[model samples]
Target chain A: MPSLPDMATPEAERLAQEAAQPADPHITDVALKPALFDWLCRMGDGALILGHRTSEWCGHGPALEEDIALANTALDLIGHAALWLELAAEVEAQGRTADDLAYLRDAMRFRNPQIVELPNGDIGRTLMREFLYDAWHYEMLLKLRDSSSPRVAEIAAKAGKEVAYQLDRASDLVIRLGDGTEESHARMQAALDHLWPYTGELFTDDAVDEAVAEAGIAPRASELQGPWDATLREVMGEATLTVPDRRADVHLGGKQGRHTEHLGYILAEMQFLQRAYPGAEW
Target chain B: MVTDTLPSTDTIRNWLGEVPDPEIPVISVTDLGIVRDISWQGDTLVVAVTPTYSGCPATAFINMEIEAKLRDKGIEDFRIERRLSPPWTSDWLTPEAREKLRAYGIAPPIDGTAPDGRTAARAARLAGRSNLAVDCPRCGSTDTEKVSQHGSTPCKAAYRCRDCLEPFDYFKCI
Candidate 1:
């Protein structure tokens, strides 16, 4: 048989567009503030890097369903990165599209944090990252829903539901592995220790966050931590895993455009198509 | 805001509901409650809606559907904007729509604990409602269990009915 793609691909793409664009502008002031734009860029940078890392597991996942799951999550995060980049473009007021921001930037220029670029070490590491990121995203969206900027709030409102589900999945896995067997629990704990430091950086403040919060575009990062803690505790307890002790070594500065060494390599692959074919459009 | 020889807002809104949700073909976007405000900005019929997820793959098709549906209705000059704040909640689901979703076998999302101090509304809603227990659509029994935290889609969960020994999908909230 010729394959389901013939039946599903076009329809899937069509559906994708429909669910994204609305018939009306939620917040019609087309102008994007520079600081807010930077914040968006920073956030996109993190998401896109994380997405690229996850996509590397396309054919390498332990199971078929899991392979698709990782790929799907990768697509969702990248798609979100693209949307945020589009918002950034508007803020720049330079007529740049999302493609321009995503494809044009060089490695050293990326603002994503170090955590996202870390190699997908093992299933344990992937689960660790997912647990942290999903919880962070869920809390952030909850705060974002009340954003002064109605546009951000709307995006959070819709995205929040999906994030919640993702978190639940990740949390379930964490619990299973932490309580599964000696080997799995050890691996999970190791992964947690390796990844925990990065969590602090996710909630760090920068000028963009300040401006965006002031503008009502989003909430302060500080406000998210309390809820994040509660959520993490709930999940950890269920998983029978002790939460990683709060680390003093805070990994900060991604929001300020500084990133780790791995970001360069990731960006090289991500931006290659765009840079090679300037102004390329599908 | 009536114009010369133009139809009323009510008529326009009714026509707009003709647009079906691109993913769930069984229901219209209006039925999903994603369609928020519908108004005219000049000749353009601007319809406001929120996506079910930030990175939902169906976004592209939803936009096309809206455009095609409106164009078919002889209205163009339309634009679809993605809204993020006051974020779309499952609580916005209409009772009629919820009933349809349940009949369709998709367990609708239970509302979140309100973050905006709307304890009164939440309390009122909780008080007035019962049957939060979801029935497995496949087996038509409330003795259903969540199989996995993740389902085939981001918005759904894998569920199995103990009574009927059938597995189904449940729509979940973030």
Candidate 2:
């Protein structure tokens, strides 16, 4: 049968043929594939880490509605994580799968930005963190949709719609909590201040970013800050929460594989089953 | 010995129609629009399926069931392909699926397209309620309210009807 021209192909088959089609086959750089692989890990790591953090609230949400909503959000992020890591594995051209990368790697190898790995302090902080992350996440996906790399663009299209829904919810809740009663308002403001330092790492671009952006595989990490700021400005203004003006470069090194101690604790819990029993499957 | 002629594409679709969605048992995978395409690749059968949402955990199980059903139908040469582009959409749900959802006490998605875009979503935030006016699946009253933007599953949102005081799941648009 003829290939279905309308249907999207698998990532592996596409990547295998990616270099042959000369239109914009940047994967031929051989040197660039590792950088692309690292960049993909950053995308996957953040989603997986934040998804794990959000899922900690599975049965513990402040309210039933919030509980169910947070769990759903966690599921969506995990799903995105799986997709990104799957692509990352394919690019590594190594014999590893997404599961192996997720369950086998040590914390030192993880490449998620620092903000996501921080503890979910409280309901206010959790919501505040999600809102902050969602704003940045949405902005990046919007730009990734235009990536010259087909795999990046395809996953972006698939994940973009869901992130929009997530951002919408997170921003709405942040506004209500930030502008509500005095107690809630104070708590939200506190959460913002605590989380503000972490947000700086999200835009700290480096060599991996430069390689991917030059290859047209992904955008520079710093490019996303502009749109992220626009969203935070509009949403924070409405929420009556003030953006911390201290600094935007207070934290960095997450994308470069330097992570906080929290990631190790997270991995112990997250990877216990797979670590204890190698290649375990249900 | 097998015959040279394979089952028609329509016949394969009919067999797939027997597979119920794991979460929403009332609807078949076809009804939910997860099965995107079916065709023969030489002697092998190719089935393209898209997950309703990227993170839905049920996708692997659903794929297994599809494989099992096809195998049970005596089709040994087959492969499942995942389609992501022209990504899955709720608008693809069959009209009959909407009816079945209503009968099952889950509100059909508001006759809405794709995701409610940012502008409409922001408007709902401003209005302090959902933009879509969802009718009660049970009481059939228009006076209903959204309880949460998400629900027990990624594909659903939670809502409640004022007249019936009944909480239900709304098949989320996109």
Candidate 3:
């Protein structure tokens, strides 16, 4: 557990207050549970890894606008991770700060998918990844709004809007790239071919899903796949790219915390501060 | 002093309606869909708010503003919960608030209600058959090109004028 500053300060009181208020009774009630905690941690880890990956594009984007957009989205994902990590900390009753969970966790312990951990290959590849993730994330949030768990629903409702924006941007980029020129179209198709194998991992389920689903707090990952595929297909078609045929015999274990080699590096950069200066605060 | 029932949560909510968002002063946090709910847990008042985006940077300030505003009203035991699960959306932009955003030199977020809310309306109110005129903020020229999908901040995008060659920000609908 990370040691926070003295709890008597005005700021601490404010933070406590902010964390204590519950939303709609119906939604908030169902969201509070042990299962939700684990789900949030997994979800937060995913966002944190992806945020770090996207942040790498800060000054290297093909265009100024794209640079800002990717940076802003990275910031948004980081913010989302902080929120979910806070919830996860609260679940354990461990008093861990969002910074603690985000910066302290080691690589092997993280549950973010290998796809997010992968480097942004190219502008077209980056856009395709964003399109696929945003499509799933946006659609998930939409469904989550009506979830039995109000807290989850509430967060989903709010996140749905952001993901919707991301989806639109991805859609625009896909169309622009797929229809822009022959080279661009060919590159996008190649990007799809490269990214296709990893897409299977997104929906693969295991023990964690079993736990969360039984709790009624999180919908199954498989449940989100159909819509995810449909959306991806439509966008890829518009981009003049064909969806790469499903690559069978591919291993899937992101949900189980078995990640790609890149995750280690991403975690090292993210966790360096916490491990170096244990309990250090800005 | 004779004891009386504390003001209902609704009363506190009504009082909070006076607190507007710091950036877009024309809109209140309530109208922005950030404020989730207000309630009383014993003598303590709890206010729930969600940030427009995760790591919005404005959230810390918004949380402080809520505390100060409520404290100003003499309600000290109040709490503010910043929930981030269901993220904030542009759909929450109230009709009046949307107009205010536009007037503030930021193109109001498109309601996702088909792309032609202002472009078509402004066209119908114009003399030409084409409806793409964006009415330049500086020179009032209809000729413009969206130069970038990003601007000075995450919430806005950039547009350039073909007529006057001036660049301005469009508050995108996110």
Candidate 4:
């Protein structure tokens, strides 16, 4: 309906190529395809939702430089989302396109972890949330470069380059702001403490994670925690910020399609055009 | 004689060499190395293009230009594929293209500093190391400082000449 390339014709040439190549045993298991699709959706959804939130700062950043930087980060995240979702659609072997998955899904159908969907409160809070998420995201991408699925590896490698820059910038700003004025420091600290509860959701693993881990498509989410912790310890140490004690996530379930009300509001604004006029294109 | 009407890959490549980047009109897309591979897929001409930045708005325009170029050559059966693996790097910019960028008042990406492959092996850059200096394209001053990591375009960084104090764009490495 969105003017997608016709994929209904199952060409014998492609079928023959698929039949001829020896499949990766981990991913070729037909039962695991659904799990893989879910896993890919989680990756793409996180990027998209967070990207939308970051873009909200487009004209509103505290300064010109900050505004431009935030916009660039948003663009990169949205770009990464497109790649991940396109691969997800391919893995599903359905007629759905990446645009369909991104624009048509309801709040309950999204697989992004809850941390990404929470509202961006203030500049300090936004930066604090960004720092925490960047650490985990970078670690996840680093490990994903070795994914058994070469396509996954390829995307990870590409996105990892960009995330490295994002993580570095976020860490630098967090340190500067957290150690700046007493007022700025207090606000940053408050942001870290407030956002800590949601951080756990990023590493919370489930049946989908188990499937992807077993299939070598991705590392178990928990495995990224150690690296995430090390990066956090280093960054927070320099920022003079105290990270809240690690605890089980009470604000969870986004990955499982149970999200905070914030996500519904976000989807309302994000999916408005697609919903208002189906198949609409600029 | 009739079968020889098909153009060679090199000829198609030359045709593409004439298409300038939408953002930087002075430089051709082929010189930027976004045009990755040209081959014949069955009877159709296949052109593989890569994006400089993941979210670059120019990609759609680039694709259209490539399609138009092919159409101009009477090749209607061509397919343009977006190739993502191996990733596009600033390192791929041609020597002549880099010179052109410099002359256009935008510093070319620092040679051999586009952040190497993978993170584990790239600790030095990942550790907040700066690229030392970006010479001002206007006054050719090595005393320039970075204004910001991002510039007007995603691929460029804002900078200013320390000597002339004039702002300029630096094509970012990576």
For DockQ, the strongest prediction is 2
Candidate 2 residue lDDT tens string, A87-166 = 78867877787887888899989999999999999999999999999888888888888989877887898899899889
Candidate 2, residue A251: the lDDT equals 77
User: Could you arrange the candidates by DockQ from highest to lowest?
Assistant: 2, 4, 3, 1
* DockQ of all models, two decimals each: 0.19, 0.37, 0.32, 0.35
Candidate number of the best TM-score: 2
Task: Report how far residue B128 has shifted in candidate 4, in Å.
Answer: 11
lDDT of 4 by residue, A226-250 (tens): 8888888877887889878768477
lDDT (0-100) at residue B92 of candidate 3? 76
User: Could you tell me every candidate's TM-score relative to the true structure?
Assistant: 0.77, 0.93, 0.80, 0.90
Candidate 1 deviant stretches above 4 angstroms? A1-34, A58-60, A63-72, A143-151, A203-253, B1-4, B94-105, B108-132
Model 1, A1-282: lDDT tens digits are: 111111122333333344343332323444445666677777677777887898899899887667767876776677677666766675576866666677777765567766787888999899888888878787777787776765566556655655555665577677778778999988988888888888887777767677777767777887778887887776667566777768723777666667777777777887777667765645
lDDT of 4 at A280: 91
- The DockQ-based CAPRI class assigned to model 1 is incorrect
Error of 1 at B49 (Å): 2.6
lDDT comparing candidate 4 with the true structure: 0.81
Minimum summed lDDT over a 10-residue window in model 3 chain A is located at: A1-10
Rank candidates, TM-score, best first.
2, 4, 3, 1
**Quality of model 3 by C-alpha lDDT:** 0.68
